[model samples]
Target: MKITGLMVYYYFVCHKKLWYHLKNLNLENESENVGIGKLLDETTYSKENKHISIDNVINIDFIKRWEILHDIKKSKSIEEAGIWQMKYYIYYLEKKGILIKKGMIDYPLLKQRKEVELSDDDRKIIEQVLVEIEEIGKKEKAPDNINSKICKKCAFYEFCYC
Candidate 1:
């Protein structure tokens, strides 16, 4: 199965979420948080280059100056996940023979911007993450939920909890 950027984000947020997503159990559309995020993505760069897709697997928010990849986020609440998601995109393009070494995450709501780079060390980590993601996808059942604080705000909260 092909892993999308969302999978990478889910991997950092919760392993169970990652597994469920790999299993094709999607709940993002049902959540207001996701809806707001989509709104931000659509509105923030409405007049700019946006929503460029590659091989129908990776959806980049925008490419600036024909090089830098820009990913828009609603918030920095889970910044790490967004950063890795950007790295994953850069890695994906590099594997496609496109040498993209940098990316940026724009948190319009928070008025913050973070630049991301894919290094040799990050390549190693991403390789390991890909392996873990493959294992998660192979599981027949989703992993048990851990009941973390983030669960309350998760789109799958009702599916996994209430």
Candidate 2:
């Protein structure tokens, strides 16, 4: 079972989502919001700078100035997950001796950018999250969905609801 930056993202957003993802039950392809997000990711940056996969574990949106990693998002609605996702990227690279220290979340739609740093505390949290994510992957079935306001915004809304 591989833990990806996307798993890290969904772990924070919804454990049930993490489980479904681990099971390969993808709903993003059927999601209009996901389509828009993919479009933004593709067109917001230079194609050459996109989809930089690190050791096949994490797919970075791009790396800027040869050091700073950037993740382009459509909005800041789930910014916490974005921050942790960025931190996970930093942690993964550091473990591989890449030693990246800075990250930024670019919201081209809003023209906003948020800087992220990998603190010692964040590294510890990310390690714990990786463990939790792996455990979720090994579950017998997808965890029970927890309804929330964010559900409507999630690509898995239809799968979880109607």
Candidate 3:
């Protein structure tokens, strides 16, 4: 399976969700939180060019010129995941001969934004993550759910819990 920016985000958020996603057991369409996020993504950045898909692998929310990338979020509950997702975007573009200065994660609901920059160490970690994700994708069953508060808002909540 191709490693996507969303999959990279899921890797940090929940391994089970990542596995479910890897298996094509998609539940995002049945999610209310996801619906809200989609609404927010559409309405919040009306003026900006959004949903920029890179080689059909990653879909960046937008770009500020060609040097900076922007990703919008509904909240910062899994902020680290969002940060890593941004770093991965920077790394992906760099591998394609595009030099990105940095990335910004926009939490429109919280009225906050966090800036992310790719480091040599981050690139190494992302590389390892890609390998690990491949391993997860090969599993016969979905991994155990995290059973955290975050799960309540996740797209796979019902599938995992109910």
Candidate 4:
């Protein structure tokens, strides 16, 4: 299975989510949080070349001058996941002979931006995560729900909790 950027992000957020998403049971469209995030992605970077897709594997929010990549986020509740997603983008592009200097994660609601750089070690970790995500796609059933605070805000909240 082709591991998209969303899979990489969900891998860090919750493996169960990643598994469910791979099985065509996505709930993002029904989530209020996702709607707000989509709005930000649409309105925040009105001038940039947005939603760059590569081999159906990675979808970048935007890139500035082919040097810096940008991704918009609703919040940083799972900041680590967001950071790894940026690193994965850099890694994927490097493999395609395109070198990105760094990635920027923008939280327009909070008026904050995070600079992400891919390191050699990060490349290795991202590769492993990609393999792990592929393994998730091969699973017969979705992984168990992670009863974390974020679950209450997830699109699958009602499906998993209520």
Candidate 5:
């Protein structure tokens, strides 16, 4: 299966969310926070040189120098989801044998850019994660909802909690 960076990201955030999304069940409208954040990300990265492509492999936010993939984010914290998202892009590019030197997570809110280098080990780990994600997606039920402080602000709170 062709996995996009977003899928990897969602899986990292909540496997149930990824399952819901892949199964054509989404609750994006239940939370305007997610929509607003998406808008801001698009607006912030909407540059003339930015190349947005939604292919079977992944939805590329921007291709720097036609080599590096840039994933622009607007989150306060650099979560595992964000890191895996960048790695997913790097994996796709590497699997395609493209000259993708690395990937970057551009946090406009923090004015910080984290560069991710894909080493051989990193690639292997990403592949393993992908396999696990795919297996999780095939399950019949969603994962248990473990309440956390982060869930208070989560876009999927209403669906998973209330």
Candidate 6:
């Protein structure tokens, strides 16, 4: 299976989300929050020069001559999940023997940029995380829904909590 950057993002955010997304069971299309994020993603990236390879493996949100992969986040707070997602992009590109020197996570809301680089050890860890995500998806039972402060802001809050 081709692991796209979005899958990696979902995996980092919520395992169940990745599972549902991979299985084409997502039901959050009606969420305005989700739509807003998608809109921001599209607007931030160049429409003509953008190149997407291997489904979601290489999503060049905005690429300049320097070959930098930029991911724009609309969230006010930076989270580990975003870092993991960026790392996964690096890992996937490196696994394919692509030349991805580094990536930048642009938090538009915070007006900050986080640089992401993958070391040899980081690749190993990302591979392990992917395996774990796949295993969780294959489980006979889904994990129990646990509400948290983050859940209040989740696009699937209504589907999972309501």
Q: State residue 133's C-alpha deviation in candidate 4, in Å.
A: 0.9
* Candidate 1 residue-wise lDDT, 105-136, digit = tens: 99888888999999999999999999999998
What local lDDT score does residue 86 receive in model 5, on the 0 to 100 scale? 78
Ten consecutive residues with minimal summed lDDT in candidate 4?
153-162
Q: Write the per-residue lDDT of candidate 5 for residues 1-162, one digit (tens) a residue.
A: 777777888887777778877787877766777787778766886663664664666777788786788877777453678888877787777667776787887888888888877778877888898898888778888888867676776666777887
lDDT agreement with native, every candidate: 0.88, 0.89, 0.92, 0.90, 0.76, 0.71
Clashes counted in candidate 4 amount to 0
Predicted structure 3: lDDT? 0.92
lDDT of 3 by residue, 42-152 (tens): 998899999999888899999998989999998888899999999999998999999999999999888888999999999999999999999999999889988899988
TM-score of 3: 0.96
Q: How does residue 143 of candidate 4 score in lDDT?
A: 83
The residue ranges of model 3 lying beyond 4 angstroms of the native Cα positions read none
TM-score of 6: 0.83
lDDT value for model 6: 0.71
Deviating ranges (above 4 Å) for candidate 4: none
RMSD of 3: 1.0
Clashes of each: 0, 0, 0, 0, 0, 2
Give the root-mean-square deviation of each candidate in angstroms. 1.2, 1.4, 1.0, 1.1, 1.9, 2.5
TM-score for each model:
0.94, 0.94, 0.96, 0.95, 0.87, 0.83
Put down candidate 2 lDDT per residue, 1-162, tens digits, no spaces. 667899999998899988888998898898888899999988887755689887688999889776899999999988999999999999988988888869999999999999999999998999899889988888997788888889988888878888
Residue-by-residue lDDT tens digits, candidate 6, 96-122: 677777888887656688888878888
